[model samples]
Target: MACGALLASACAGMPDSGDVEAVKASNAGDSQVRVYAVAPRDNADPEEIVDGFLEAMTSDDPGFATARKYLTKRAAQSWKPEQSITVLTNAPHRGQADRPGDPDNEGRTFPLTGRRIAQVDVRHAYRPEVPSAFDTGIHVVQQPVGDGKTKEWRIDSLPPGLVLGEADFLRNYRAVNKYYFASDENWVVADPVYIRQRQDPVTRMDPVTQTVKALLEGPTKWLGPAVDSRFPSGTELARDVRSLAPDDQSKLRIPLNGKADRVSGVVCKGMAAQLLFTLGDLTSVRVEQVEILGSGGTSLCLLTKGQAEQEYSPVREPGRGENPYFVDDRQRLMTLEAGGRQPDKPAGVPGPFGKGTVQLGPVAVNRTEDRAAAVLDNGHELRVGSLTSDEELPEAVVTSVAPRLEDRLSAPSWDGRGDLWVADRNPVKPRLWLVPGGQGERVEVGTPWLRDGTRIESLRVSADGVRIALLVTRDDRTTLQIGRVGRGVVDGHEEITVKDLQDAAPRLESVTAVSWAGPSRLVVVGTEAGGVQQVRYVQTDGSTSATSVLPGLNGVTSVAAPYADQSAPVVADSGNDGVVRLVPGANWQPVAKGGRVPVYPG
Candidate 1:
């Protein structure tokens, strides 16, 4: 059946049921086209030099050599490019102060300041370390040139890291996943980040070295503690080599610095998997085997493509997702096992979910299939319960303490590590939190970019646990954004934060529901124009195709496709019909007609 049902209620507002505010139809396409940063000239002034150097930092120029032109030879070599980054919204203003109490002024401090929004350290970490009253200071040295006819002003010292506007940042950097294993050492989760990729595709510049370097730079702030890596500290490629291009045999010999030498055999095996997965992430870098080379070009280990699976693997598509499950007309959680056409309602274990007057909205089943999280009492509260109703819904792990409409929580999601992730939109206590499965202690995660006047409408954590899809509404416009989840440490305690929040479908006007459809793709619903409800495919990096629409299914209140399938079966919460699954190039098979949210195993 070509299921066609459209209502303003279908793809708008919070999940479950509630009084929903209507939003205008809008279109969010794929990407915002950006140009490469222009290189700076040699004879610019201190102010221009500073600005140009900062701008050049966004460029994927080899080694940032172009940016080095703005500094003195000594400063250029001493400046640590990765020490920290100051996120700014505008151009920095230069102010100079002469030496205090000096009748004859010898030197001055060049102070540059702007509206610094956020700061990140080299570890790709954040912790309010960048002060609100932050400013970069540069020491100006007025010295004589060759003939001393003309004075040359060179920067002696400057603040660490780079600074750039949000616009330039979006244009210049692209977010890619660095793979890591879940806490239980079961599956790999991605650590997503905005790293600069070489823009000039025509040059055929290999990103392997760069990607490996960023991977070596370590996981971002929010993901550090949750995951582990085999790559040792101070890990770097030999100074003589920058890129890890493969040879004719499709083998890459990654020469590591001394830091990785003299390692145990078991550690070598783990390190091999790390290099394989890390380098394999780059779109341009293709290799069949990765050989770990120690100092003096000693062969430490080699990992073939096939061997990588045994040691460790990615969480992208673990081949573990199950058939669609949803609440039936009897208010019970039922799995749809194909029988004839509709489905057989095989009740999971224990009592039926959403029985009687107990209403349930969206339900998230962890990848392990042992438990599921759901919203109850008409969005007034959230509970993590056993899928088979084996245990009473987990004691309202999250709820609307504020009793405000905006304070309502979204359905919970489970990462590969089996952690429960939920969001609270209460403007007073807007937060993203994690509940370790079966555990009560609530660990609050931070979202630094969540500005005022914008509230989270819907959220889904990635299977990997490193990325999240958020439906945010601001000024009546609902947009789909993707955020990188990470972790940091302070005073021996762990802190979690999300970084590099970017629009995944910026051209779409309204996005009702979003679900991970592949490793780097999302199935998004909403209209490009005319309130024409349709399911569209979108990339996590904010790239969408104008014609990438799944036309048949309309007015889908909810939808689910395997995160690894670009053209996976379409599981839809069809209006008034409950739940249905439309396999690719196949007919619609009814699962249940009274279910609202249809989901695949997490």
Candidate 2:
């Protein structure tokens, strides 16, 4: 008897009690249909055992107990399903079974093949890769059955972890942002990780609990060097706690183990903030306050939503995000009144740039909206001036002599620390420079990867000043990469560098425009290989959900997002539609007739 035949007979005898559900059909295969694997029958063939084991791995069996039935006892004991995950573009294909050496041997090996698109390591960190060939093998051998009278085939050698198709992986896993503080700064950074959408089989923990555990485990490898966690070493949920929920007052109380019992009140409050931010989007529970409890169930510290915003938030003032500026037809700076009163009307900025005195290109405003930086003289000169007063234009803080205007300088950006950053894309001497307080002497930042004809086309500094988004062009192909911003002292002098570059949008063949949409998300304009243009949101860890892709647009030249406001619209410059903005649940609406570049203060 085969595995499928045995499963059919066993299911026929089971009683059906649950409500009958409908499975909607679509062009894309439905992931709602649950899969349940059955044990391989006695005297099963090698091919049956191999196929049955693969099918079992995709089912909902607890601990994959059914899958182990088709594997040898030794193999089952050594296999660690949670070690890692390999995501394929589709279900793996099995090749014909063949004996290792002798044709009469009972052992046979089957090859598993597919196109791998991404991988999740033991730490639950997801890394996207260019689609590539995936090849592996599974070996099975004849084994003795009851009383050693009959022989059964069982998998003897197999991979250590689970392999899932894209659709199934999407259904079973969810992307979550784990919060960690910037190494030297108090601001928290988002470290993305994937967890089971449903209850984890081995841990038997709910989704919220799983995310909390992952957060306590600390940051991912790529971001570990730049961020720190407030949770004490070896700190975890109190033993015997299975689920967490808020009380009637919307306050969630998290009980930690003994390791966290000795922390100071300040450190405890930081831990509460980390917990609040980490669980912000993971659950529907309205958590207005987080109270940390010691091992003995005594409250150590408490942090409210309002308190976290005022003290440990990325944006100190919520009002700073309302002023979004853009470059108009006359090459002047203009601001949109987005405070629910005359939302579409454009007003002139209060300075000389608003009076059209200087022809500006790409522009960036300081976080306080009191200062602005622009590329003047067709990108050859970088200028910074006050936006609140009609003061004379300041001298050029930086200049480039690249022969062509296009190769002179990229857009200028301001981080939350009031520092200015820009890249000179000159082929002869490419460099990245940072100006402290937008007035200090520019310090050249080292970028070792900018070599062999590779130049930065554009760059956006994250609001935390700990990460930067770069559009790097090499061999005529541009890709979006996120690099860590390191600031420290080297041999007596202060040093700043951007290092540990990771591809943030691996699926896009080329990226033309990119901006930081939130702490851990980016709005990018790019296209996949052999595909049309697209606008999408990609996580810093290189993961995207099914709904990440936005609606189609004609042609997007630049994209900008407000880091402080999640409700603010995404502004973009379109060649065919002029300036437009995409608000939630609405289509793109025209903002200006000839606006070229729209930007929100970082």
Write candidate 2's Cα lDDT for 352-409 as tens digits: 7899978888999988889999998588999999999999998988899999988998
Please give the range of 10 consecutive residues that has the lowest summed lDDT in model 2: 7-16
**Residues 400-481 of candidate 1: C-alpha lDDT, one tens digit per residue:** 6657655678767777667888888777767777887735677888877777767888878877676788888888898888
Flag regions of model 1 displaced more than 4 Å.
1-259, 263-267, 279-289, 304-311, 314-321, 337-357, 388-394, 401-407, 426-431, 447-451, 486-495, 498-500, 529-531, 545-548, 564-568, 585-590
lDDT over C-alpha atoms for residue 301 of model 2: 95
Superposed Cα deviation of residue 580, candidate 1 (Å): 3.4
Candidate 2 residue runs with Cα over 4 Å from true position: 1-34, 99-104, 319-321
**Each prediction's whole-model lDDT (CA):** 0.65, 0.83
Indicate which candidate wins on TM-score. Answer: 2
